[model samples]
Target: MEKEDLKLLQQKVTKLRAEGKYKETIEACYHLLKSGKECNDFKSILTAHINHAASYYCIGDTEEAFNSIEAYVEVCSRFGDEADLLHQYNVLFLLYEYNKDFAKAKATLENCIGLGKKLEKYNIVSNGYSNISHVLMEEGNYGAALEAGQKGLEASKLHKPASPILELRVKLNIAKAYLELNHFHASKALINEMIHDPILESFIREKSQCYHLQGSWYRKQKIFKEAFDSLTVAKELVESYRDLYLLKSIQEERCQLCEQMEDVQLGYRVQKEYISLLNEINKQELALTALKLEIKHSMSDFKRKANTDFLTGIFNRSYLETTSKEWLEQASVKDENIVCILFDIDNFKIINDQYGHLFGDEVIKQVSNACSKTMKENELFARYGGDEFVVLVRGASLESGKKRAEEMRGIIGNVKIEMGGNSVSITSSMGVTDNLDGKVRSFQELFHHADLGLYEAKKSGKNNVCVKLADKE
Candidate 1:
């Protein structure tokens, strides 16, 4: 693709991903990757993988998102792109934290800070310290968390254009640390200032956190009425966004609502109501937990009807249309190397005429079985009409994807159906491509490019595998 073509694809995919269409975003990234003349050795590969990984992260595929990020890191490492490395290291730090690898998370953040210092990128340094505070907080080192957050704020002052979001994050971390250390006055000062800040209007979650912390401080000071007011606002704010975690925390605090009140009778009445509400909350939480467990088991049942093909009992065209982009996004989410493998039976029309429709049905079913045997457990495989099949392989690069396609072709060819006193052989032409290029907007477009490779495979004779990385033009 030309520079203008790549830019156009980027803009289109950006719009799609911004619209929360992660599947489309992943496909776009596949095109982006294809546009780069040499993704395994190119600078633009960074943007391609970043966009690709973010989509994967958004779609609950952390593994693939991280894989995408790892590739981004690998390319950056090769080019000595420290600035990009510094930022992506934060991403790696968070990934480690998400996986409860606090030791590695802290180390990654330290590395980020080191790169920031080397590059003199104060904003990166500030964010790195702020992240260190998060790890420290997780490790129950409140004093250290507070110190790191203060360092973050100090570094922020030097980062030009100023990041209010970063500043607010550091302050929130500091306030929490102070409260944990029983520095009531210090925590209160930060909370009071932030609670009324105009910036909080655009950051409701931060505002809610402020109110919740304020309520906790007031409650500790034996000021129940003020605590109640703050807690109520916090509850409203958290519930507005349906933030279950914050809501639950607020609810837990709200349960002791009437403590330290002068009016004993009124306090008792309010306490009783809160106790009842708490009881209801506990029951609801129990029900919610049970429902989640049940859904985990029944999810496949829900998907099978709409997604499965009746003939081969594999995924249908509809499934591919609905899920390719989603699978792409999911692949990108985990920073996973995602490969789209497109293939079709060689001389299928001739086979249909020679062996008749019944034999063709048998061939299709057997081919589907061969595909199932070739691919991994959770790979997305679907019949793309007639004899064409599409497999969205997550955690695989173009190289691995070709291997898988070849395996499938070989397996399908080895199968012979003896019918009408004759035996039949099957072969496949395949095309494989990756989404790391950061080009294209949907899986369809991504698949179409892979199809170009398939067309080449056909030209190279029946059973051939071809890959499309970037346009030779």
Candidate 2:
């Protein structure tokens, strides 16, 4: 290959890059590097490789992009090219940031900044600081992001940047970092300059973004009217840009606020009605209260009988299922936690077979007693099936359930029952599951998970408690 041919190949690569055809650009670069022995410009070849790497990075192929950057770094180091070295560091920094390796990304940016300062390349220093701030913001290290953004602004002030538009871009980046860090006043001041400066408008979309940031700041301050007004304007601008998902979210939030307002009004009306009704009640109030108490007592008795296992005096499967559904609904709406425990006597059927029916009944009763004593007050303890019982610890965390289940395991394992003048020890295996606040679990699904956990406990070793992973749900 001649020099003219290599130059033509580089031109074609530049054209492909401009067209955003990254694969074609990389392929052309690879062909030139492989086929052109006559091409002697090592720096130009390294430039092509770095450009190819940047193209891949733009297309979200960061892994391949980083591999290309590594190659470029080696070539640039061999040639002692400081500019390409800085570019390689910046590229690697971005790759780490994209991978959510924030600490490593920050370190790389700082290295780049250090190199830029030593080389008197203020633009590179500003770029490094700006990117570090962006990474910190993304990682929710907002305070650090604001500090880094301010440093970037200071770096920009030290540079005679080639592009005047670069200053506005850097200032906008600083304001964005401030917004993320909840430095609303500082962000607002920077944004106000953008709002009044006509030059800023041509270079950036600052107007709507500034309004959105101000609205969010107002929201944090609990000035709902101000927040709503600003957000409404931002919503209009975002809608014009056809950002439908964000528009829908804003509309949903507005609708929810409206619903909350209506609920408050309705609650007031309900309270008024209750007061009027109570005042209208005359001599019958005492009798009504007495009748209500009697009715409540009767219903409680009826519910107990309906839900209780007759033989063991624990909750039956019917009650556990019904109560579990109710608890599941409450947890779903209120973000409450619930734990379900499924326990079965180990080799229960064998005991029934080896011993007489009376002894079997005694074993079941002993197991139920063990469950009752082990559970907390008002916790649902039910006989789910023959020799199988369930415990529902409402508002129980995973840790709490483990402790409670372990206590039950110990109690059941240590229990000594005298049947037919013989003392026998019984062991039970339990599966415990507690739903987290954000999870939506049905009663049946919860029960199924607990059962699967029980199977695991049995397989691991009987007379123990096992917890299911969140993924099992």
User: Which number leads on TM-score?
Assistant: 1
Candidate 2 lDDT tens digits, 299-388? 466657766899998878877877788888888888888888888999888888898778889888987886677667748888888888
Cα displacement (Å) at residue 81, model 1: 1.8
Question: Per-residue lDDT for 94-120 in model 1, tens only?
Answer: 678877898999999899888888877
Score residue 449 of candidate 1 by CA lDDT: 81
**If scored against the real structure, what TM-score would every candidate get?**
0.56, 0.47
Off by over 4 Å in 2: 2-8, 35-40, 161-164, 176-183, 205-208, 223-473
Local error of candidate 1 at residue 176 (angstroms): 1.4
| C-alpha RMSD of each candidate structure in angstroms | 11.9, 24.6
The regions of model 1 sitting more than 4 angstroms off are 13-19, 37-44, 162-165, 240-242, 256-473
